[model samples]
Each structure stands twice: as structure tokens, then as C-alpha cells.
Target: MTVRERLMYIAKNRYARRIPLTSRLKAVLRAYLHERGVIDNDNLFISVENKILGARSIQDRLRQYGNLTGVNNEVTVSPNAFRRTFCRLKVEAGTNIFVSQRLTGHQSLEILRRYVEIYGKDLEEAIEKGFEGL
Candidate 1:
């Protein structure tokens, strides 16, 4: 896709909303695309029949990989779980909630808050940091 087209894709507010890729992720994606000979503007991922992969297909693939890697043995591995973990990690890493909301495409802070799983240690750390200059 052209640079303008990619920017428009990122600005679009839809289920297929695109996010900015990290440099590492960009390199990995470039390598994968090169390996797959996918130089066109087609979908990044596709099914065996060359069709776009749906959400269920993606989740099924995650589950399959999780099972193969023994990650599903302790907990369920799904896209929603990844989303929650992403939000939680962003919060724990001190990313602004509004930034996380924008990144996650969350329409409301209330909904985004539900995805952040804070712990007692996090609370203690927050308290300590809050009192650091006092």
C-alpha cells in the first residue's frame, strides 16, 4: 500500500484498525512478508484457502499454538486474554490510560479500566512513588 493509504488505514476507526508497529515488529513483519512472497496490499494473514482470517480463525490459531507450546495447560489462551494482558502491561509500565485507550481503541475509559489488572504490590509501589518527593 502507498504511504497515504497506510496512514488512512491507521486513522480508520473500525474492527480492522491498524496500530503503529514497533521497529522490531516491523522488521519481523517485513521478513515474514518477504518469506511468504506477499508484496501486495493483501491481508497480512490468510487462511489455507487464501481467504482473510476471521476473528474465530485467529483465536483458534492462537489456541492451537498455545496447546502446542504448552501455554494453554495453565490458562486459556485467546485474543481477549492478550488484549487484557496488553492493557495491564501498559498500565503497569506507566503508560497513560488515555494513551492505552487510544492504542486499544477503547471508546471509554470505564471499559478500558476493566482490562487493567492491578495487584497489591502495584498499589504499594504507587504509594511509594507518590511519597518519594515528600
Candidate 2:
């Protein structure tokens, strides 16, 4: 599916009372097994009505897809990476550190401090330019 369509599906399926997309994605993933008639389901997006896909199952399928696509990049993808990306995007959007810290569920300022350290130098340069009027 197209990127926009996929995003819309995610939005719709997010927090849905039934059939969350994670399971649906797994259903698509289990397609090969199903095609071999090893599995009975005709639809890939299984009903979250039954249960959410197990975390380990999701990870294993991701690894399988990663292998199938020849995606041998040294970096590993995990759920935490998505959180980090979201945090960085929030910082880039100029959200305050305290607010970002809360959004990220960080119990200590140190987590926010790391993001500040990562982006702080650039912020300092930007800050330096604002004193001409003073």
C-alpha cells in the first residue's frame, strides 16, 4: 500500500477496540505460511478481537522480513528507536525539555539532558544570534 494509505490505516486502527493493526501486520506477514495452507486464515489482519500479537512474535517476524529484504544494515530496529525518533522530532519542533521529558515518561531530567546535549550546540548558535537588539 501507499505511504498515505498505510498511515491512514494506522490512524484508524490505532486504539481501536478490536483488530489493532499490529496483529493485522502480522497477518500479512504470516501470508507465506498461510499460502502454503499451513495456516487457515484467509485474511491476514487477524482480529485483535482475539489477542494482540505477542511481542516476541512481532520481533521474530520483523527479523524475518529484514532478512528477506536483504536489509543487512548494521543498525537494529526496535520499539525504543521509534520513541527516540519521536523525542527528537519534538525537540526539533521546539517543544520544551520539561514537556518532552514528561511526554517521554522520563523519570529524570538526565534523559532530556541527553537530547539537549545532542541538540544543544546548534541551539547555542541560534541563541547567539538574538542579542543584536540588546
Candidate 3:
């Protein structure tokens, strides 16, 4: 997307987030947005049957997907995992912390930093870089 269009999306969206786009994922969301054409609802994730999906419903779908995909049997499948992973990925990718805080709906930089401190997978590398040429 062009910068103008991306900015417009961020400006107009309530819970704005830019999920990393894969081919199939982009296709899926585009299809979903197309399906929502001319339909206005507060919840973007409203179901086809017009019911707002509650937390439990989303959790159930996550569990189903995890089972279907055979992901990480030792790790519990939950929404927190997705959120923390997103935060970690953004930090590791060198995205500006403020931008990550906005995208992740974190209220403050300190909270976002805590997410980083908790989920950073390359702490050794980070420390090494900090102490480089010492």
C-alpha cells in the first residue's frame, strides 16, 4: 500500500493493526473485506451469521487451528501467545518501539518494554551488540 493509503487506514481505523501479509492471508482478508462491502458494523470480526464473536469463540477457533496444524504440543495455545509473539517479532524486526506500541495497543512504552524484556528471544545477541567493541 502507498503511504497515503496506509496512513488513511490508520487514521480511519479504531483498532488499527498491520498484520504481516502472506499471499494466502492477504487473499483471505481481502475476501473478507469484500464480503463486508457496504455493511457497517462496530465489530470488524462479526460472523457471517451476524453474531459478535466473544473471547471464548475466538479461543475455541485458536484451539481448533492449533490442533489442525499440529503446532507446539508442549506449549498451551492461547491468545496471549499470539499477542506476545507479535510484540516480540516487532521488537526483533527493529520496528520503532513507539510504532510497535501503537500497533499492539499498548498504553505506554514501559508496558511495551516489559513485553520485550519478557519475550525477546535474542537477549544474548542484544547484550552482545550493546557491549560490542568493549
Question: Which one wins on lDDT?
Answer: 1
Root-mean-square deviation of every model:
4.4, 9.9, 6.0
True lDDT of residue 91, candidate 1: 89
Could you tell me the lDDT of residue 6 within candidate 2?
Answer: 34
Per residue, candidate 2 scores C-alpha lDDT tens digits across 1-134 of 33323322222224322222365765675684555553455443343453456557666777777677766375455555556877888888999978888666666888766654566787787888887578
Per-prediction TM-score: 0.74, 0.43, 0.59
lDDT of 1 by residue, 1-134 (tens): 33433322332245566566666767887798778775444888876677888778888999999999999998889988988999999988899989999888888999898888567998999899999989
Q: Model 1 — which ten-residue stretch has the worst lDDT?
A: 3-12
RMSD of 3: 6.0
- Which numbered prediction scores highest in TM-score against the true structure? 1
What is the TM-score of candidate 3?
0.59
Higher-scoring candidate on lDDT, 2 or 3: 3
Off by over 4 Å in 1: 1-18, 39-41, 119-134
lDDT of 3 by residue, 54-114 (tens): 7788889989988888885766688878877789899889999888997777878988887
lDDT (CA) for every model shown?
A: 0.79, 0.60, 0.73
